[model samples]
Target chain A: MKSLKIFLLAGILVASCTNDPVEEQDSWPVDFDALVALNCRAIELRKARFATADSLRLDMDSIKASMNQSDFEKYQNDFETRKNALLSESNALADTIRLRMKGVMSDLGPDRKRVFNDSLQATLKREGCE
Target chain B: MKRILTLAIAALIISGCAKDDEPTVQETPTKSAAAKTYDADFMIDYFSLQCDIVRNTNGFLPTIAARGYGYLGVTAYESVVHGIPNGQSLAGQIQGMSAGSLPLPSADLKYDWALVSNKAMADMMRYMFGVNLNPDDAILIDNMEANTKAQLSAGVDADVIARSEQFGADLADAIYQVSKTDGGDESYLNPWQTPWEVPEADYCWIPTDLQLQPLSPDWMNNRSFIANIAEDTQIGAHIPYSSDPQSEFYAAAMEVYNQVNNNTPEQVTITEYWADDPFQTCTPTGHTFNILKQLLAESGATLEKTAVAFGMMGVAENDAFISCWKSKYDYMLIRPVSYIQEHIDPDFTTVIGTPPFPAFISGHSAEIGAGIKVMIDLFADAQGNYTFTDISQQQYGFTPRNFDNFYDLANECALSRFYGGIHFTMDNDKGLELGIAVGDAVVNELTWPKNIQ
Candidate 1:
């Protein structure tokens, strides 16, 4: 009787281990509203970052407009270096949000995924985050 | 008897666990009797991957990306041309390609065209994006090829698989050879022709970037795939240069100045949506290709239809850029930002960074115009109306924009440049005209398969 119980327990353990995590997660209800909120926050952050960069660029342009060719060239090189670094950071942020959204929507059927994406976009637009 | 029962129970438990550990095999579709029966999922997925690669690759600017797409599209079409009934190969149609240039598959052998397309696309992508392709993207290409092949090869004869892959690889090689002769080959190494003599004219383009050089100044000299398409599609002339406040040229400058000054939030959004800066986005050409991929997936297009669409659009994109560049250098018109600051408003600043190139014809305007025209022809009705949501920018954290017609989207893309204060209205208008002419030529000139419905 002891041996039988042990065998049964092993079988159950193996069976549980074999279960597909993706399918199991698919069965769980998704919090789509939370995802929309997350996406909105990301969009707002990106917009703010771009605004700051644009403002800085405008300032740099004003400063360079009055400089001689030599000074202008030096300043432009420094400005480009800074701009590239900021762009990389901005791209990294966007890539993270995209991956997260894709992960959440992975289990959804095509129709549902489209509907969810559309709804999220609508919300963003309505809230003026985009 | 008790020991026997115990052993039987143990065996049963082991068997049950073994069953759980067994892999679940997916059911393969019935062996396709003909190549036309294969769905376009493989082609669509490959093109989607190409878009990602284009976006991530270091030096795939618009001109280089357009040339890559042109070759990729031809490879795709040729890989499956034999499967489409009445389909004509592009060997004779495109420039520098002769009849019987590509190796043909056995007439009597059964070839899976999807496998052919899969292998060809994989090879061409590696070749076209050589050196610039990161390890992560290369892994993606490998995984996609393996997964697609596994699905396509099931229930098919091994001989057919071998033949298909060989033909695909050979086709890609042949196309690559053809691509090498195009003047733009390996042009990515020196995108900005440094130390180039800026034409000393009052109206010629001046550098606006740190590099102090124009982007792809020699790109206009690249060979166009379509014969005479570049020459035929060139813009007539730009608005004459004048610093006088009352001149049309100065008015054009002031228009850009005022637009940037009073740009609404919505206008700014539009500008950002279509900005498509290289190294950030996939540039203008890649954005257009992304839209095509989305539409193809939505409609459940077959490999045949998808290949033809890619082929046509790719040619259109390559030629459009060439023609646009020709006009750009020929006229060497000054960008709006330079003119506005010097003549109209010294304090003027554009909403977006001005690209370091001539601005006579907006590259975005011309490329998107050509792309949309191909899309409209392939997917639109007789009245030229097709409704679709463009989510191409969604991956970049931008909200999806909806369009009722392809023309509306093209026009919006053109207008975005103006609103951003980088292009004059005439630049956009003439750019559209040039693009539409090229698009029309691709549609009318190419002898694609009829009765695709």
Candidate 2:
């Protein structure tokens, strides 16, 4: 009975310390280094996507220049299908990165959030996203 | 015997004078002021920094960016005009800037024009974007100023350089003072004013996206750099908005939808290249300036000519946005995306993201129109057939695009808006027309000296 009473008191103390359940659930220590690494990863993903799209575009240009109109049309339709799929994939990746960014942003206090965003911008610019 | 001795002495004297003339040096021709040029590398760096700031600044609409560029360009021009012979001040010619307003540079003092430009830009940028800068930007501004000052101080007399720097600062101060009263200050860097409440009337713009915040709705309320831009320019009228599939308005929406649906790879490339969209990317205005910078560098232009070109571009673009915005808000016409989703296709999306604003005259078309016209006026007579590769987006890993002429580039920029499915055909056409007129006015109406021309 004495041990049970001690357990109850400890639970009450824990609840009192974290009275705001939503804040307790949402707040976490932001690893700024990890966040920056994530930003770089996002930029790399974008660069890859852009490069792939550019290659596909160049191939289309060459094919159009060399092929007959009928053949070009068939190829063009196929290219469009692939392009749409690529766009969807790229968008999904961007969305995932964006959500991670939001998590980082939300975890920070206002001052730290501003600092993180500024650092992130500088990093992205250096990474050629500027 | 005495006569012979005197004649012999005279002969010796004459011989001595002739020998002296043989070793005399000819004077080197003095270079004309037009030939005089200061270091322009800093201005290029300064503008690139401006692009960086524009990229980072939150909610910076294109019109606002244009306004900021106008000040930066004009300040750079006016600060260094002392070094350019026969270069006239734009103060009295441009509206609201008076002959009495400018502080004249001291006559016959050897001045470092680049130093002058550096000081003016440093001060102007610090003040112009002062309210909006984050801590990182504030530090950048300080570092940029310090580095410029350090560079200018090398191998230069302290007193003279100090005087020259002060002269530039004074000029910028005078301009900044005038700017404060121009209604720009109240709206400076404020890009997200509560969108003007749409009236309960026919053809009003309805919100399309979930966020539903229209951009820069009160932009027209900000005074134009050129007063006449607001009063004189005409966008005429757009086809009245309608839901009927056969109506001109509906037809325009259909065209946007179809083009987006049937977008080719070439069309996609054009759209993406000219989009010059958000993030730390140089906004469209900056992109035009970047191209101009490249052209100027390659043309081997003197600093005076470069300054004049940038100054004219600034005025033209600044006024173009003013005229474009006036038309946009005057109509409050709905975006094609909004209309298409409601009336044409619920499942359709644009090839590129739609900017948050009313659709009428496209800003990109207007800016390009102004840019090409001003460029032709300045350089086309010489470089009308010149071709150059645009490496502006090299950092983004895109291959450089080439243009045969400024016109070709401008036309491509205009067409890109249509391909992106953001503008109606008429918007691009009419915006270009308006921009051309504005550009012409800036060139013809301004009082550049005949000597410089």
Error of 2 at B167 (Å): 0.8
Q: Residue-wise lDDT of candidate 2 within B322-432, one digit each (tens)?
A: 888888888887778878888888777666667777778888998888888777877676455545666565333333476668778878899898888888888888888
> Against the true structure, what is each candidate's TM-score?
0.81, 0.71
Fnat of each prediction?
Answer: 0.26, 0.00
Which ranges of candidate 1 are over 4 A from the true structure?
Answer: A1-31, A34-38, A48-56, A59-118, A125-128, B1-35, B277-279
Interface RMSD of each: 4.0, 14.2
**Model 1 / residue B428 / CA error / Å:** 0.3
- What is model 1's DockQ versus the real complex? 0.16
How do the residues A20-48 of candidate 2 rate in per-residue lDDT, one tens digit apiece?
A: 32232123455545545555654454455
Instruction: Tell me the lDDT of model 1 at B157.
Output: 89
TM-score: model 2 vs. ground truth: 0.71
**Candidate 2 CAPRI level:** incorrect
- What local distance difference test score does each model get? 0.79, 0.70
